[model samples]
Target chain A: MDLTVTGLSVRLGKRAVLHDISATLRPGRVTAILGANGSGKTTLVRALAGLAPGEVRLGSARVDTLDPRERARTIGYLPQDGAVHWDVTVESLVELGRMPHRAPFAGLSAEDHIAISHALAATDTEELAGRLVAELSGGERARVLLARVLAGRPAWLLADEPLASLDPAHQLGLLDRLRALAGEGMGVVIVLHDLIQAARAADDVLLLREGRVVAFAPVAEALSPDNLRAAFGVEVMQVRDEAGRILPVPIGTNR
Target chain B: MKRSTLILGLTALVALLFLGSLMAGKAWVPPSAWFTADPRWWIVAELRLPRAILGLGVGAALGLTGAVLQGFLRNPLADPSVVGVSSCAALGAVGAIVLLSASTPLIIFGSAMLAAAGGMALLAGLAWRSRSAVAFILAGTVLASLAGALTAFVISIAPNPYATAEIIDWIMGSLTDRSFSEVQFAMPFIAMGCVALLFTGRALDALTLGEDAARSLGIRLRRTQMLIVVGAGLAVGASVAVTGVVGFVGLIVPHLLRPLTGARPSALLLPSALGGAALVLAADSLVRLGPGATEIRLGVAMALIGTPFFFALLLRMRRSAWI
Candidate 1:
């Protein structure tokens, strides 16, 4: 599935947060949205996920026009923090992902169980299934929440700053899992602050300045120094590693 | 405890307490009297039965509403009484008693309902303005205090001494001498409220992930809020209309049941309802057993029993950040 956004705008009270943002997010790829603070990256993702009032298109369907259940069926969204309030078991928390699919009064079906197990296995959280979510480390809890969204088996996953709090190793692991999801033809869109990680992991990149899209292209083409400097008001330079691959580095912002 | 065991145990406890409540009074009525055409049986059938049934309904309503409010507001301390709905309803009832000479039950019921709805509307408005749980708790405390003061003010300026005495008893919360008419009036609203609340179980569970995630998962925040607020208002309003301001049952029941139900807000509802019923029945029985000419108020008994538990829960929440 391909997720598309056109003329998406958001206003919180009187202040405009996101304006006329448009992009194409293809399946079987990881797209990272890079922006500075208050750059409306979160707003754009929220609008795409149908959480905010905005016009978004997913394939031929209008995202905002779809019912909430249909929207949930098509897209799984992970907000930042992803706090689980209760001490529920990991399996039970994951089972909640099937809510959009199941009837309100019905018990979980065989298909639901299969999806739950696949989600657990996919996120490598099966070992922690019986344990309380509150007992897990921060990275582990993030993975469990990832499993929860995965259990819904949506065509696209939209995550806001999902990698913000993770250490380097855990970030790499989660990025790998996300990459695996993309390899399975699920579209993954992530909001990120780290330019290095974006250069490393993103197949495509969308750079935002203020509320508008500045660059939307393949990672290699879009992460140019000029685009980086414009989007973040920072001096970015490209350096070659021992592997002879170019990497983008942010040294400092001109005050 | 396992979910099934917890549920079953609560149900059994409610039943046992209910029977004990029917048998308990100023004087012991034998079980044999229940089978025969004795005056004691008349007392059981007419007096104790209605009061016991009211106790069950009132308790269930308060407990279920408490659980729903806690989830809706995302605050563990949220309850009908604490949030001012019960006291608002009490103010409505007392106001009616003071203003009207020989007010009918229907008028009192309507007044209470309106007051409950108004209180909920205010809470909803405050919640809309500020989504912070602490803000909501503070707002609720303010509203509760205001309603309590209004109730007292109305009582002091009551038109007659009889009206003042009636207001005092009602404010303290009592199921004494309540008839089947009160039960019939309250049951439908209570049942509707329970059904509405239980239907939001999945939505509330989704909310444990917070509002944005819940909305992304297709849970409509406005719809869920409407269900919770309206359902709780109806249940709590009708309950207070019959038995005034039954404090602490709502607060205590859900807290006690949370750990047993694995802290899942949805799973805590039924057990909390049953536990609330049992708690009220037990407390009412204690009121009857208290050695006094004038029966100790059921609400007073619940406060006496529940205040320590509330303190313990607050300490535990402080230790664990469970709130």
Candidate 2:
């Protein structure tokens, strides 16, 4: 199904974080929101999943018109900081992702159990199932949470800086995983601080500055030196001359 | 171990301890009496047996509800005492003791339930309407102190000979003279509360990542939290209504169960229930045998026991980099 956004606006604390932002994403594609810190990247993705206050009008029909309960079943979001305090087992933590699918009083059904197992396998956490979350490292926790998101089998996966805490290997590994999910016909939208990584992984990129889209197009035009300098006010160089320009680093700090 | 094995072990421990509580009271009875009726065994059964069982039920309810509240609020310090549900419950029991201490058993139990529920309603409003955990604790503290003062006011006006004495016991918390009927009355509310909390386990797990994160995942945050508050009130408030104010069972039991369940809120719920019941029952037995002819307030005993236990836990946690 086509996921379209039209005339979407959001306000946080009476300040308009995004004003009239609109875009469309296909089912089998990776879309990226590239921005510096505090540039409203987190808020935009959150608004799409109904985490932030915003109007999500899909064409003429309002996304807000859908029952929030119904809306939650179709979308899965992994936040910037995966806050955790309890020391629950990895299996239990992942199974919680199945909440929207169950009735209030009944415990996990057979279908729920299969989803939990599949999630553990997908995130490579089957061996860590019995271990307490407290005993695991940050990377392990992130993987478990990703497995949690995947358990829901939602149409769209929205993640905020899924690569931030991960090391380079895991970062690249996670990007490949997201790309694979998109190939499986799931819409994957990620808010990324790493422009080079975003360029490599995404089909379309939206560069945001001051809570508005500075550029929205195929990754090629969006990652050009002019766009990067305008959005971040930093000079950078690129390498790959493909559909997307890679910006791991620019030529020099000196203009 | 698997979830099934841990749950089984916890259940077995509760059963063995449940038996220990029955046999360990004053005026020890023959071991054979436990299996069948003896005329002499009737006295023990008639008096102390019900009190200890009631303690188990109340303790279990306290622990389970505590686990639920702490999970939902993401605060380890939450318990009925911290939230004023216990104090309000005490006030309810005190109202009966003050006006008609010798009233029919039914009236005393009924009044206790009503008072505790009233107190719970106030605390629930504070926690539900307000978003902050610190604010919830503050509101509970204020309500508890107000109830405490009101209880004192009622006592000051009383003309009975024991009013002054009973006031102290009521404020502190106790398990003395608890009858089978008290247990029977509280069992349903506590059971229902336990069911309510367990059912919300998935929602609680979603919450661990953050409220916003949970909401985006399609969990109805307000609805889930409201269920938790109501469940906490019934389970905790009814528990205190029966046994006065048994503290720490709630705070400590979850901590103990978390390791086995691996710290997920959903997995910890069942273990907390069983573990809490066993702990309170064991502590109740210990205090009964400890250096006291008069009954020990179970609440007082738990605090005395909980400190060293908690200290050990903290030390282990610190070493493990739990902060």
Give a tens-digit lDDT track for model 1, residues B216-248: 788877777667767877788889988887788
Give lDDT tens digits, candidate 2, residues B13-54. Answer: 988887787777666665688546676477557656777677
Superposed on the true chain A, the predicted chain A of model 2 yields a TM-score of 0.91
- Among these predictions, the greatest DockQ belongs to 1
Native contacts matched by each model: 0.73, 0.70
CA RMSD per model (angstroms): 2.3, 3.6
Tens-place lDDT digits, model 1, residues A128-176? 9999887888778888898899999999999888786677887888898
The CA lDDT of each predicted structure is 0.84, 0.77
**Clash pairs (backbone) in predicted model 2:** A87-B262, A87-B263, A87-B264, A88-B262, A88-B263, A88-B264, A89-B262, A236-A250, A237-A250
DockQ of 1: 0.72
TM-score of chain A of 1: 0.94
Candidate 2 local Cα displacement, residue B307, angstroms: 1.9
In model 1, the Cα lDDT at residue A253 comes to: 87
